[model samples]
Target: MIEWLLLLLPVAAASGWLAGKRSAETVNADSHSQLNSAYFAGLNHLLNEQPDKAIDTLLNALKVDSDTVEPYLALGNLFRRRGEVDRAIRVHQNLIERPYLSSSQRGQALLELGLDYMRAGMLDRAESSFLEVLKRRSHIGITLRQLLDLYQQEKNWHQAIAMAQKLHEESGEATESMIAHFYCELAEQHWAQKKAVETTRFIKQALASDWRCVRATLLQSSLAMEKGDYKRAIRCLRQVERQDPDYLPEILKPLSECYQYLEGQDKFFFWLTEASKRHPGCTSLVLARAAYLQQRGEQKEARYFLIEQLRVYPSVEALQQLLALGVPEDIEAASEPWSLIEEVASRLLKAKLNYVCGFCGFGGKYCYWQCPGCKRWGTVKPLAVGT
Candidate 1:
């Protein structure tokens, strides 16, 4: 109540000042008294904590003149901040309808109305209001940002990309990463439709926007594999290691498939060995190496490698590898330890989220290109399971 009274102070003072100036010119003492009485009655209602009644009294008492628009805007914003979207919309709509409003005032009212509509979940109305502001070329950056959010929510990637481009051009902020993701979304759509040519084109566009886009590279590899181009698929998958080693886990199975198709078991071993050396403590690479060693009937070698790696990494996945490499004799002797290890590993693996949003620290088992908490793109990263 006190806060509302304080907020109304400026309006009351402004009305008094305007009335006094007009009174000197026209001597309208009777109208001035009525206005002053109405102002106090509104203030009294606010002080008594009758907010709704106070708002009504103030709205009725306030004139939509040049001087009053600022207070009206502030009041509407206050209502919006209070989560009273209906009242905020009423105030802003009333302000916008007044013919005496300045251009900037009208633009501001439109922006507020759009925000109210957004809060009310009237997205179509919000979009229309924002579009009107966009057409006027006022508040272009903010309007474009809101429109981009709307498009993103609606999954209209083309419109999102267009708005992001406009924002990039106008603000000189690098939105290429976001644009690349948008293109990747379109690429996924094309891939789902089996439009190979268009999918390839969109993937290329994604790469053009962000040369290090791991998703694009992954899609390209998948496309190549679909076409029976094993060598090309391997090349595309290999690019992911350089682009973002965090996504190396995603490529392992696919890369193994390509190697199998090419009948390049030796080459696959060599590459896995090299990768393990470069990316030390990588659980996926270590597991792949262990599998290769076991396949080659080098059980002792695989056990030694798993033990050596586990001593340094101390990860649940590494422990699993160690257990898998155990000899039949050791299995009986180590049965209890192995069971406990398995239980602990299962719990740890379950507790660990695969992806975490860099923006808001929101961790999830599944990946989200845009964080649900912070709504940022490319912020969620694959959590390193054993490294």
Candidate 2:
């Protein structure tokens, strides 16, 4: 309320100046007198701590015209910033209804009114206002951006893709990554519906939009795995390492599964060794290599591999796996202390976030193609080991 009062002081001053200007003119002396009286009545309401009445009185004193339109617009924006969306809507609506506003002024008023409606959670009304502004070819850039946001919020990926393409054409902004994510969204929807052809079509569109889209490649790999084409799945999974090595962690388990289906653990171990040497920061790749060594009856080699990697990448998961490797093969011979320590480490690993958003610092146990915090596509990646 105090902030509103402070903001209203300048507007009140402007209103008074207009009233005095009208008073200076010989005509409408009585009306000017009434305007000044209304202005003071608003100030009196402010003094009495009745801000709502004060706002009402002050707005009533100001008439919509070339001079007052800007002040009203500023007031509405201030209200919206203060979370007073209804008041902002009323003010902008009033300005929009006036007959004397220029095209630009009316467009500005509608844009602000659309923002007001969005803030108030009236999305349909906001969409209408934005579309009207776009239809008028006023504020085209901002209108397209707002429409994109609205369509995304509604999960209307097709409309979002169209709006994003138009925005890209108009501003030369790089929206390919966003467009790729939109296609991925559509693909996932079709995948859920068991529409393989539709899913494949959208996935192809995603990769065409952005060849480095790891999500699209992952979807393609999943589709291949579903069709029992392990070789094609392996090929798609390998593409991810080149496209984004940071996502190597995401493909390790799936790669192992594909190899298992092919009875090619030796091949998987070869790829793991190369990936671990090339990207040592990814703890999962290193751990997978160690696990493969252990599975091949090379316990000592696996232990050494884990110890070497743990020195460089201090991961809770790596530590837990190392501890498990130490336990004897027979349950009867298992050391009680080692088992307890391994259990504790396993708990700690589960508590850690495996993925984090590069844009917004949002951390979660699962990977997300679009960051839940920043809502940006392809910004969340596997968290690097050792913080």
Candidate 3:
């Protein structure tokens, strides 16, 4: 209420100033006196906590003229800031209706109205208003951004791509990663619909947009695996580790699976060794190496490796790897909460990690190309320490 009063008082002063200006010009002194009375009445209504009455009084008190546009704009924005979208819409809509408004002034009004619509979740209306502003070429950067955000929210990747391209050309900001993510979105949609050909095409487009896209490589690898092309899958997985070693943890399991399908644990071990050496003290790579040792009846080596790695970089996964070595093979897999300890431990590991947004530290079990918190593209990736 105090905030509104603060805003209302300035508008009251502006109304009086306009009245004084009119009186100075010797034009309709009687009307000027009347407007002054109405303006004071509006202020009184506002002070009495009748906001609707105050707004109505103010709107009626101010004659729509060249000098009144700024006050109306300010009031409209104040209403918007207060989350009164309907009132903001009305104020801006009223401003736009004034036939004497300058072209740029009308554009400003339209932009405010569009923002009100967006705040109200009237996306279609907001989009139309933004497009209209785009035609006027005023506020081009902000209008393009609004259009892009609208398209992204609607999942209209095609339109988003075009708008992003325009925005990049105009603003000189880096949007390649976002364009790649949009292509990836299209790829995933196609893949979900079982259109492998279209999926591959879109994945290629994603890589072309940004070749460092790990998601694209991961998707391409999955498609290759589906076709029994293990070698191609391995190649793609290797590219993922190279492109973003932060996601090596994600690729490791799939990479191991691809190697297993090819009946080449030897090759998988070699890749894991290379990755571990390249990314030293990486817990996932160390554990993968330990698992390989255990499978090959090198239990002593696996235990020693786990102990050394755990001593350096402790993780729930690494600890589980160590404890599993102590669990005898005869224990029933379906035992009590105590028997479920390993399962609990593993679940905790997966739970603590999933995907995290680089921009805002938002972690979740699922990947959102657009971070739910910061809404940045390609910022969400597999959660790792220091990432």
Candidate 4:
């Protein structure tokens, strides 16, 4: 806000000069005299704490010129920061209508106006303003970025893909991951509408854009599973562990379903045994192994396995699995362990989120290719093993 005052000082001085100039009768003789008198009167108003009149005296004297637009831009930005959207819009619009503005100056006004529209949730207008900015290509990178975000907000994934590609080309920024997410979004839209062919096509496009996209891999696996192609579904899901181990928990149930459908329980046991070794202390792996042991008529082995796991790395999921088996008989220890562990686990279970943003620490129960809090692509990853 102080910055606004600083900017207004210069604009106010120019306004004062204009006010005095307009009030003068004799241009040659009394112009200079009238200016000095007005300047003193404005200062007297200021010294007397008549700020409102001083401001009025200053603004009523304002001249719209090239030199003045920069400070006005600052003023407009201040209005935006204050949530005065209409005022900010009017300021930028006024600057844009001035015939004296240079091309670059006009672009600056348009960019500011676009931001005003964005802040006010008028996305269509903001999109138009940014697209107009892109026409000159002076600020292509920022324009493309804003357009991309706008498209995403509007769920216009096709437009988002085009804008992201344009941003990549213009700014030399890597946008493969973001492009993949856009394609995945399209896949999800198609899948939700029960358009399997379109969904498969979009999922394939996502993989082509970024093979490392686990969401696309998951969608591909889902599509294959729907077709009763267990082998293909298993292949797609197995790729997830290699592509990014962080998402291994997400594939656990899907992998189990594929193996179950194929009656490959023995193969699953071997795979889980190997996976437990590779990703040791992984919550999902430990929990899966416990259930697997229980299913194999080894309830005692499952109980002991969970006990050892708790000693190595205590977790809420493991505790829940333990309670399902029954509370242990520990009468005299450093503390009564069973209830203590259960209490801690309950708190953690309530507090912990399933997915968290790596960039901004935003957490949610569901996965998002783009972070809901930061609006950043590929930042919201699954919660790692123990979180």
* TM-score, candidate number 4: 0.85
Which should have the higher lDDT, number 1 or number 3? 3
lDDT of each: 0.84, 0.87, 0.85, 0.81
Off by over 4 Å in 4: 1-11, 14-61, 328-337, 384-387
Error of 1 at 221 (Å): 1.6
Candidate with maximal lDDT: 2
> For residues 216-290, could you state the per-residue lDDT of candidate 1 as single tens digits?
999899899999999999999999999988888888889998999989989999999999888998888888888
> Could you tell me which 10 consecutive residues in candidate 4 have the lowest summed lDDT?
54-63
Off by over 4 Å in 2: 1-4, 22-28, 44-56, 327-348, 385-387
Regions of model 1 farther than 4 Å from truth: 1-28, 40-56, 327-335, 385-387
Can you give the lDDT of residue 85 in candidate 3? 87
Clashes of each: 0, 0, 0, 0
lDDT of 4 by residue, 1-387 (tens): 344345446655665455455546435446456546655665666667664455445433344566566767876787789887887888788788878788888888999999999999999899889988888666777788888888988999999999998888888999999999999999999899999999999998988999899999999999999999999999999999898888889998989999999999889878988988888888998999899898898877999999899899888788788767765454443456766876777788888898999999999999878888999888887774753
Ranking by TM-score: 2, 3, 1, 4
lDDT of 1: 0.84
What are the models' TM-scores?
A: 0.87, 0.90, 0.89, 0.85
Candidate 3 colliding pairs, count = 0
| Residue 295 lDDT (model 4) | 89
lDDT of 3 by residue, 1-387 (tens): 787789778976886687668666877778788777888788788878887788778777667667778988998999899898898998898888888788888888999899999999999999999999989988889999999999999999999999999999999978888999899999999999999999999999999989999889999999999999999999999998668888787888888898888899899999888878778877778878999999999988898888898777877878788778875456565667545777778788866856888788998988776888988987888654322
Question: What is the C-alpha local distance difference test score of candidate 4?
Answer: 0.81
